[model samples]
Target chain A: MADVNVSTLSHSPKDPAKGAGKLDDSQGNGGIPAVELIELLFFAYRDFVGDADELLARLGFGRAHHRVVHFVNRHPGMRVADLLAVLKITKQSLGRVLRELVDNGYIDQKAGATDRRERLLYVAPKGEELARQLVTLQTRRFARALNECGPGAREQRESSSLP
Target chain B: MADVNVSTLSHSPKDPAKGAGKLDDSQGNGGIPAVELIELLFFAYRDFVGDADELLARLGFGRAHHRVVHFVNRHPGMRVADLLAVLKITKQSLGRVLRELVDNGYIDQKAGATDRRERLLYVAPKGEELARQLVTLQTRRFARALNECGPGAREQRESSSLP
Candidate 1:
């Protein structure tokens, strides 16, 4: 990953919209976003996903496979169209990954009960086990981070930060 | 983008290692991760990078290009080897992206100061401008997320969570 900003980051005001106010205006520009925060997010996310990525690599799969297996596991029997919407990827791309998973027995594709034309996705038993492993690896990191941040941090963060 | 855990997430205790103690163990297993937090990270990162991705697409570029431009703009005269280390991508992959950037006039390649055989990279004025645009789009999202989380949130989170 690239370093977006190359400066020693200092504690800046919480809301730049409120300006520097009565404190030191070392940041100089109130409009400038916090560089440290941006870098932190980049690194954190990289390591978070990197854990599952390593396991996926060992299976001769990529992140695409991880994602397909995860979603299918979560929504069991979700329509392929719905999966496409959630992934924001084209059908052509999804077709490639889905085909690979289905062929490899990680995912099972079925016709919708009511509408035979509608394709539904489900994680096979093997896929479910893989999903559990991925969650375990990721959640371990999540747990360690949360624990270090003190009690109530995760709740406060999820409520404040999540969409 | 597949949902990993398909359960309605609740606020679990801050530290599960203590094993739910005096609290209701609705989570059933104290070891289970807070699915909400995992989902939150997934969606947050997706949208975070999605901002730059949209702009990169318009310019006929991808995340790889965005990364190259951002790094060269930051380090100015970093060696190719260093970039490969930071990116953790293969030489052949870097070669493709670097060649494109150089050919497009977004980046300039020069002989290293002392080691003539070393290929050093520098961002051209055009690339620097593009880097600024990418940063602006990303930081706008970053700042808004931080602001919504209230005062001191950024400082506390960055200090506690960063690598």
Candidate 2:
């Protein structure tokens, strides 16, 4: 978004670690060189999630449903209580989203093995497929960023910058 | 929020390498081990932009202001059309939000130097301060997520699983 610097960007011959995070910190001297990584994170993320959103919308699903599906897929046997904690949404809201996800065959909710009251969650074939689609969409975006942005951009800057 | 990790949160790690662009194969991975990074991103992002929101609440500013501020700050000396392209909002809606941001002294405007019809933009000192505070608040959250999630945790399993 700003003027590009050959040294701050493009592969540096000086040291494999040189451009780490410095390119975006334009002013020189003591600025966080790693800011480049930050922008990449921001820009890449905006575009990355955007890709998934479009696909989800095509199927009449929204970001909320995608999030629910992701969590269920990630932790196959978690509880509703756990989902609530992680999502931090009111039960009423979660109920609406989860219900739709479950009803649509994208997710599966099983009776808790130990406590009948708890609902154990998993990604059913349908849910897994959609989740797979969304996550895969994002992963590709990230991987591309990683490849073009260089493998050790952040690592190179880590030694010189503060978090 | 699931079993996925947010380990490298709180202190922003030295971001290793981040990417940008539209070059996606659609089959890319988000690099699994680092799946937690996505969650950290979700949590930390929600938390990161939250403070400015609270401050804005006192002044009737909302997330729209945040988006406006973020973009303007990201590309200072940007044009209205350029901004509109980035935002993808209706002109009427955009006009309303833009007027509010300008009225609140959170942004400034000028006639384009070369193209008189083009309204160029910049963040006023007050606006810049607010944007800085808000973006920085989120920045730290990111720093922490990276640290806790570990540099390598999210490196591999990015794609074919998003959601």
Q: Write down the TM-score for model 2.
A: 0.69
lDDT by residue for model 1 over B1-163, one digit each (tens)? Answer: 2222223222111212211112123333344334545555776677778899989998888988988887666666777876776566799999998898899899998886677987778778788788878877776675555453455643443333111
Evaluated against the true structure, the overall lDDT of model 2 is 0.61
Candidate 2, A40-68: lDDT as tens digits? 44554566667888999998988888888
Pairs with steric clashes in candidate 1: A71-B2, A71-B3
Report the C-alpha lDDT of model 2 over B1-163, residue by residue, as the tens digit.
Answer: 2123333222122322222123333324343333554665666545555655677788788877777876676566667776665555677878988999889788898887666886777779888777667656555544554454455545532321211
Q: After superposition, how far is residue A74 of candidate 2 from its true place, in Å?
A: 1.1
| Candidate 1 docking classification | incorrect
Fnat: each model in turn = 0.05, 0.00
Instruction: Give per-model TM-scores.
Output: 0.65, 0.69
Candidate 2: residue A43 Cα off by (Å): 1.9
Model 2 deviation from the true structure expressed as Cα RMSD, one decimal place:
10.3
Fraction of the native A-B contacts that model 1 recovers: 0.05
Considering every candidate listed, which one attains the maximal TM-score? 2
